[model samples]
Target: MAARVRRTTRHSSRFAAGSILIAAATFLPGAESAADAPGLEVPVDYTCRFPSGSHAMTAVITGSIPADGTAGRPVEPRDIALALELPAPAVAELAGLGAGSVSARADLTVVHTLGDETATANWSGLSASAQGITGQEQVTLHAEGSVPTATFGSAGTATLSASDLTLFLSPLQEDGSPTEPAAIEVECGLTDGSDGTLATVVVAEAEGEGEGEGAEAEPEKPVENGGTAEPEEAAPGAPRIEGRLPAGAREKLEAARQDVEALADGPDPCPFPPIPLPTPADTYVAGYTNVEKMDGAALLGPAHLNVTLMKEYIPDPCTSTFKVLSEAEFEYGGRRQLPPAQGTFLTYGFMPTTATMELIQVGGPAQIESVSVTSDPAMPEYTTVTAEFDLRIRDVEVNGVPLDVGAGCHTVKPIKQTLHAFGTGNPPSGYTVNRGGSMDGETYIPAFTGCGADEDVSSLLTSSISGGGNYIKITQAPLCVLNDTASVDCPAKKPTPER
Candidate 1:
């Protein structure tokens, strides 16, 4: 299958949580603002939850004023960014479980009231580290752009805003594996600050079904921590889960079980079954001839010869035209042989007269090759000839392997054939034909002829070829013919005297 083309969209990594924080702090408030007034400090907390009945985890981000303590006067709007890193194993596990590529979208919104109006921006499409996340991961958030002074009141008061972000988990591996998380970093500060702090989280351990449970399941040894009595063992004859079958059924079951046990213990010779081989030849016939000549005059012979043959014999001053139409049909017994390897079959049918000849090649291994044609002697339109070629194969094989030749086995490799045209006038450009003989003023012979001038002939060749074991029939009308004269010492049929 061809791979589908995907349109890629460009995204900004600068908006990545940490980068936003760094940029804001380094460029936001100037040196004057840092020394004049006390800056606002706000602490933010983040939490995440899984599906119902699952555990939830939270992380906190602490915000404070710079050492100068004067960075929050004449406040402007600020942009907050957050970055989360997850363990690699967790990411792989989730991916293995068939979660699609994971992406984060902000579900939280913050509202601030300045002196008069308010503004808002939706934060979405959070990016994560492409690698290194294996176990518990950490995420970072940055808030530095701007917040209304009225919303938070004073730097002493805490301005709280919560966002319920959704983490989309998608499988990254073809064979579903859970994704892993390594660590997360959150950065937050005033719109104008120098730099931001970096934090890290370490994954303690990983536990799941793939891990060995037996080794981890050691029995808790009794200790001096308020233990009372030792567990007593039950009597030897106490009822237990001995079996689940009744006495009579158990007897028969035991007998069958014994037979299976015997077979397993007694087998020495290889028990594999014999493999079947394909037949070399499905069917072969003795008499398969395509052409025969009689008394210097060619007639439709054995083998299928379905083609249009046109001949013109021009004596001293008179031109005599001859035309012959023929078709062949083979009644197959369904006992057909295919080659060792699967391949396309090309069958050719030839028809020739003393002056003209035509050859037609169709696809597939089937019965009929060509059919239905219309031709005329005068007003010849010989520019282009078109013909429909049909293909059919009763049976075929590839590499000695039998193929199912049906609608279901429609896959076919490309095939091409060069049709040879012999005995004719100049064929159209790109066509080669054998030319010979001379009579009257000019001599011309055409070997290859295609459909010309007739509706039935044109339609048949223009239609799409059908597949399957069905017969393929093509109709072609060749317009070019040879002009030649030969003397024969034979008497012409006498015309009866007019009464």
Candidate 2:
């Protein structure tokens, strides 16, 4: 037997009491009929307006649904679909912003379903399109969703009403700006007809003058004293350098050059060094580590160099990329600071989701037109980090070999390296960069180092470290190029005066 339903409240009385009092009728079983069983309904004849020359729009829908418990089936799913017609084909432009196709008959589906028994609605599948219209764009919207099947025991007349529905259209630009549309309309209805009511709300276009002025005026270009003029050329002998180096060592140098270029440009590149190297206790920055130890020896090998190389060679970090940036901090003297040292290092376990590169132009002893680098967030077992830097070559030499240079044209010589020292202690095996107070028989320093490069410059004044170890302090000396007669000092730092 279809359950014996009875209406506890009279629809006439409820309607007389006012729309807000409808909730009191939920308990009344046969009081309302299926057609009149207050279900989803859209406001009668609605309309939305868009200002002239704008892409934004405001829509208002009015209607009502049966109060909680009033109908046989209390729950219902509803949605609103919108379709925009444009005079001309504009789908390509609108699609770029995730809008529907631009054709004479474009349809935009904007769905909304009620949450809980409260009749509260939420917008879903909301999208726009530009396809067919005579001269401008016209937006059309309608409500849709499932309806209740059970009917109210033939007592109160089936009620069909809706609450107010409003919609605002905006663009998803980086700046979060919205463009006003030329026109807008809204409609509402129910998808199912089981027990609930279906209502239709249609908004007609306003006939009067549209809101706002159409489109923004074009800005006038500034005129020079006589007419548009070109920029002056760089002064002669300005050390305008531009060039490219050979593939091998030149790659590493080029990577370093790109880092310098980033610093020279506005946005700050990673403040941390390209590769984390070990540092002496007296100058050690906190939180950074160059080594990890296992048992009494280096965790990976004699110098921890093997482990660092293995980790660095891994293509991906095993952990989430987001966490790697924060982990770069190192602890020193109970406080955190940037490590003070430079050299190749490797870190294990890293993962990155996105990589971005920006081209920059810097004028100095040499003018650089572009710089690029790749960064991945640190991950576990995947913590390796690889960075490459490129510079516009005015002049460059790798191992005393000269390179080619030109404008708009440049060469890339990368400085490839890795970082691995992440734990707290003298790496079990290699040397220690910073030796903290000894603990038991093991030394606890917060850093480690690894040596890597095609050429072994370890014998030269340029020191090459192979594995973990205690932080070593080396005096900062001017770098000089070797000539047959004598050694000439190479400029290590760019002078501020020129900058």
lDDT of 1: 0.23
Q: List RMSD in Å for every model shown.
A: 38.7, 30.7
| Model 1 Cα shift for residue 146 (angstroms) | 11
lDDT by residue (1-499, candidate 2, tens digit) is 1111121111111111011111211122333323333433332322222222223222333223333223122222223333323212232334344444221111222221221111112222233322222233443533322222112111122333333333323322232222233113333232223222244222111234243312222222233332221112322111011101111222333444554445557443333223332221111111112222211111110010001111111111221111122112223234332212222222121211111111121221111011112241111111222223221212322234432322332223322223222111111111112111111111123211111234322222112112334221111112222221122112111110000
- Please state the error at residue 149 of candidate 2 in Å: 14
- The TM-score of candidate 1 is 0.21
In lDDT terms, how accurate is model 2?
Answer: 0.23
lDDT of 1 at 169: 34
For model 1, residues 1-499, the per-residue Cα lDDT tens digits are 1111111110110111100111111123232122233333333333333422223333232322222212122222223344444434445445444444443322223322122212222232232322222232442333222212111111222222333444433223332232343112222222222122211111111223231221211122242432212113212211111101111222333353454346447645332232232111111111111111111211111122221222221111111222222222222232222111112222121211111111223343322111111132111111112222222232433334443333222112222211111121211111111111100001111111133322222222222222221211111111122121111100100111100
Compared to the true structure, candidate 2 yields what TM-score? 0.19
Q: Go through the candidates in order and give each one's C-alpha lDDT.
A: 0.23, 0.23
Mark the regions of model 2 whose C-alpha exceeds 4 Å error after superposition. 1-64, 67-121, 126-499
